[model samples]
Target chain A: MRTFEHVNAPDVQTAVALLGEASTEAIAGGTDLLGELKARLRSPQRLVNLKTLAGLQEISYSPKAGLRLGALVTLAEIERHPIIQERFPILAQAAASAATPQLRNMGTIGGNLCQKPRCWYYRNKLFECWLKGGDKCFAEDGENKYHAILGADRCHAVHPSDLAPALIALDATLRVVGPDLDGELSLEELYTKPTESRRQMTILGPGELITDIRVPIPKNGSRGVYLKTMERQSWSFALVSVAAQMNFAGERIADARVVLGGVAAIPWRARDSERILIGQRFSEGLAERAVEAAVAGAQPLRDNEYKVSLAKALVKRVIIDLCSTTD
Target chain B: MATKAVRAKKLKVAIRGPGKTAIKLTVNGETHELLIEPRRTLLNALRKDLGLTGTKKACDEGTCGTCTVLLEGKPIYACMALAIECDGKSVETIESLSKDGQLHPIQRAFIAEDALQCGFCTPGQIMSVKALLDENPNPTLDDVKRVLSGNLCRCGAYPKLFQAALRAADLVRTGR
Candidate 1:
């Protein structure tokens, strides 16, 4: 790892100010930043330790106000929080399905959302892919198994977070703090397609950081499910994951949210699937139609054709599981 | 709580540099003050500065759990953690599990179950089991698998490892 200065920010104000400096980066849990540093992918002159900040360290909830999580809350805490597990279990399931226990203990919710792409070409220092301000993306035609199938622009790297799909399905909002931006923004707005001008996954400008994450409590009789497929049973990134949440009014569906990961540059919201699910009761035929709509316009790469069928199957399974859930 | 209306003007943080800086680490209930660079990982500081090599380092990235250690009683990857960041926090490594001459129950169970082929991953595996049994005294088979999934035993001693974890839970429950 390249040597750099480390600063313990006394408050969010100081953290923002220091991060605004050139060749400086923020380190929350260091699970993601340390790896990038070790791989020499991001060589910063200074590291502002966000853990030293006075706030962004608590998980609070209320019946009327819903659940609010500080940015520094570890993934393990989310996986084990009683209120979260009992109320929004799909979020907990997504947190639990992430990296191993060790990484979960060290990885914070904010850092997980802002972590860089896991593309082989992007991570390898040898390949200056388009995301790195290069002319072309190597994953376009080379070893493109994990490339994007939807919303691929200059880069095809998929969003590698499991919590993103789940939280977006839950309609979570974030409180961002920065120089020009300090307000509530939908979690979906945090992401962006890798355009020639942006060349990044998120819209966070210089020194922008998330302070709080709020997930609204679902209405009564609502059920949500997060299902992921990996190469192995455990300790692997998602091959294709689905997060589906449905709100029920008596016997009919009032509203629904369906999001897919590992299929697009951002958390792919399956609005077509959700549209099919709204105002309809859960049934095998409805599930089939929704699943078909989820992958209608997918453009899989040469080596990633399996993701299309796998994503469709997971969408069907997630909807079924959400309707069948008793608790 | 800080108000959102407060604008970030200039930083008041005392910065430690690209050069060596002073920091203190509490390892195994002992505190040591040393000067080191900011990039020094907890795994390297423990092995080199503190001479506590019980914690192994493999896949220096977070992929492998060979460098697992307890930060504030929660298991985390040491290699992924910066030593400077753990200034006032407590760290429990594999060396701290046993005291005097008596082996920890998890270590004894690993020996009894013969959970080793090359023994390269034993320290990490045992530490993970210790962490699990510390939190859940009566861990089920699935719990054991979930906690130890991070610590990979390339020698393929998983079957015996599960048995050893169960046996360790029993040994601790029986107070033997």
Candidate 2:
């Protein structure tokens, strides 16, 4: 890893100020950042340690206030929290299925949400892909099995977070602190498609830091489920994951949100699928129609055509399972 | 609480240098002061500065659990952690499990069950199991499998390893 100066930020203000320096990055869990540094994908001049900042590790919840998760709360904590498991089961399941027990124990919520793409070409320092300011994406033509099937503008690399899809399904918002910006944005706004003007995945400013995540309270008779398919049983990134949350009025679905991961540059919200399910009676036929609508416009790459079917199957299974559950 | 306040005060003194910084680490109930660059990993500091090589290093990235250790009672990858970030923190390594030359129960179970073949991944596997058993004394088979999934055993001793973990749990319950 390239040598750099390290500073322990005393508070959020200090951490944001330290990040204002050129070529400086914040280190929360260091699980992803350390790997990038070792692979020479990034070489910042300074690292601002966010662990020293107080009060960023708390996880609080209330029936009226919903859930408030600090940026420093580890994935392990989220996976085991009783309130999270009971109130927002999709988040718990997503957290449990991510990485491994050890990595989850150290990786924080903020770091996980802001993690870079896991594209092998982008990760390999030798290949200067388009995301890294090169001519073109190598994965577009070569070894594109794991590339995105949706929202592939300039970069086809898929978003790697298992939690982002679940959080977006639950309508979570993020509170950020920066030199010029300090407010909340919907979880959907945190991500952006890679375009020629903006090559990065998120729209966060240079000195911005995520402080807290607020998940809205689940409505009455609401049910959620998160299902992920991987190459192996454990410790592998999701091949295709589906997060579904449905709010039912009596026996009819009143509202719904379905998001797909590992198939898009951002957490792909299946609005067509959600539209198909709303105000419809929960049934296998409804689930099939929703699943079909979910994968309607997917433009899979040469090697990733199988992902469309896999993603469709996952969405169908998750919707049926969630609809069958009782509140 | 007073001691914690004092330690926080001490850590508040930031290191504003353009080069290596001095920091103090508390590992295995011992405090060691070392000067290292910010990029130095906790795994390297443990092996080189403290000379505690029981923690094996593999994959250096966070993928492999060979560099697993306990940070504040939670198992984490040492290779992915910076030593400077561990200032004023407690770290438990594989070396600290045994006391007074007596093997820890988990170590004894591994030996009895022959859970290891080449033993390259033993320390990490044991540490992960120790962390699990420390929190849940009576873990179910599924719990053991889920927690140990991070520590890979290339020797394909997974069945015996699970058996050893179950045996360790039994021994703990009986106060052996």
Native interface contacts kept by each candidate, as a fraction:
0.91, 0.76
Report how far residue A267 has shifted in candidate 1, in Å: 0.3
TM-score of chain A of 2: 0.98
Instruction: Evaluate residue A214 in candidate 1 and report its C-alpha lDDT on the 0 to 100 scale.
Output: 97
Residue runs of model 2 more than 4 Å from their true location after superposition:
B1-13, B16-18
Per-candidate Cα lDDT values, in order, are 0.89, 0.90
10 residues in a row with least lDDT, candidate 2 chain B: B1-10
Tell me the TM-score of each prediction against the true structure.
0.97, 0.96
Give the top-scoring candidate (TM-score).
1
For all candidates, state DockQ relative to the true structure: 0.58, 0.46
Per-residue lDDT tens digits for candidate 2, residues B110-145, read 999999999989999999999999999999999899
Q: Alpha carbon lDDT of residue B79, candidate 1?
A: 95
Q: Pick the candidate with the highest lDDT.
A: 2
lDDT of 1: 0.89
Supply the DockQ value of model 2: 0.46
